[model samples]
Target: MKLYTYFRSSAAYRVRIALNLKGLSYDAIPVHLTRTGGEHRQEGYTAINPAALVPALVDETRVLTQSMAIIEYLDETHPEPALLPGSALDRARIRAIAQAIACDIHPINNLRVLQYLGRELGASEEQKNAWYRHWVELGLQAVEAMLADDARTGAFCHGDTPTLADCCLVPQVFNARRFNCRMEAFPTINRIVDRCEAMEPFRLAAPSNQADAE
Candidate 1:
């Protein structure tokens, strides 16, 4: 198996954590996202993933894209330590939490989106950062409320075991810290991230631990 990744991509980071949790080893193919106007944009990468996204997983000859789909595939293929919870409602809740960060927060502030805001929309760096922080804080606040309101949230996001929510949360926290987003209000997020960081899998899969880390 092989995993193509970018060092700081939160989407890729989520996949990294999922792969580690499953105890799956793969060739770490580092795809430099920003070396020369983004490696993901190159034809070779686009052939693997027409979306031009980071984290395209190759097992045997099959290449899979999208972090959530890859994670579900991993869970299905390797069910020893399941990354999802039991029951339909529990699964829905876990997916909701993950998507709260992955869809709501991430897409709006992606590197390409930020670049578009600056180059096409005439947004300054300061404005762009503020825009990023705004969505992150808003989304995180909602997640905090959801967790605080629910009894299912434990050391991890979904019960005592780390599930898909935890997988998504830790990477978003990494991105939050990188962008200097204030984390004081989101105590649950910080706690989960701390728990995840203590594990070797999360530690080794960190952006700084990557081969192409700057």
Candidate 2:
């Protein structure tokens, strides 16, 4: 297996964490997102993923795109240490949390969105950063309520073990900290992310530890 990834992409980071948790080894083929007009936009990468997104996984049989879809594929194929280990209701809850970050929060703050803000909208750096912080804080505050209010949340997002939710949460937290977003307001999120960061898989999957980290 080969993972076409960018070091700082939160979507790619989530897939890296999932692969690590599954004890799977794959070649990390770095695709620089910003250098040379973004490598992902090049023909070679577009041939693999027309969406021109980072973190496209190519295995023996197929190539996969979308971090969440790739994660679910991994979970289904490698069920041990299950990423969504629980009943139907529990699985739904876990997916909800993952989507809350992957879908709601991340899309608004993605690199493309930020670049558009500055390039097309003529927004200043301060304005762009403010845009990132506002949405992240608002989304995370809602996530905090979801986790703190639910008794299902434990050492990780779903239970004692890390699940799909934790995989999504850690990357978002990394991005939040990168932008200097105040995290103190979300105690539950902070606690869960701290626990995840202490583990070997999460630590290994960190952006700083990646080969392409700049």
**lDDT values for all models:** 0.89, 0.95
Question: Candidate 2 overall Cα lDDT vs. reference?
Answer: 0.95
TM-score of each: 0.98, 0.99
* Model 1 ranges off by over 4 Å: none
State the local distance difference test value for candidate 1: 0.89
Across residues 24-58, which tens digit of lDDT does each residue of candidate 1 receive? 99888888888899888999899999999989999
What RMSD, rounded to one decimal, does every model reach? 0.8, 0.6
TM value for model 2: 0.99
Candidate 2 deviant stretches above 4 angstroms: none
lDDT of 2 by residue, 76-191 (tens): 99998899999999999999999999998999999999999999999999999999999999999989999999999999999999999999999999999999999999999999
**Which pairs, if any, clash in model 2?**
none
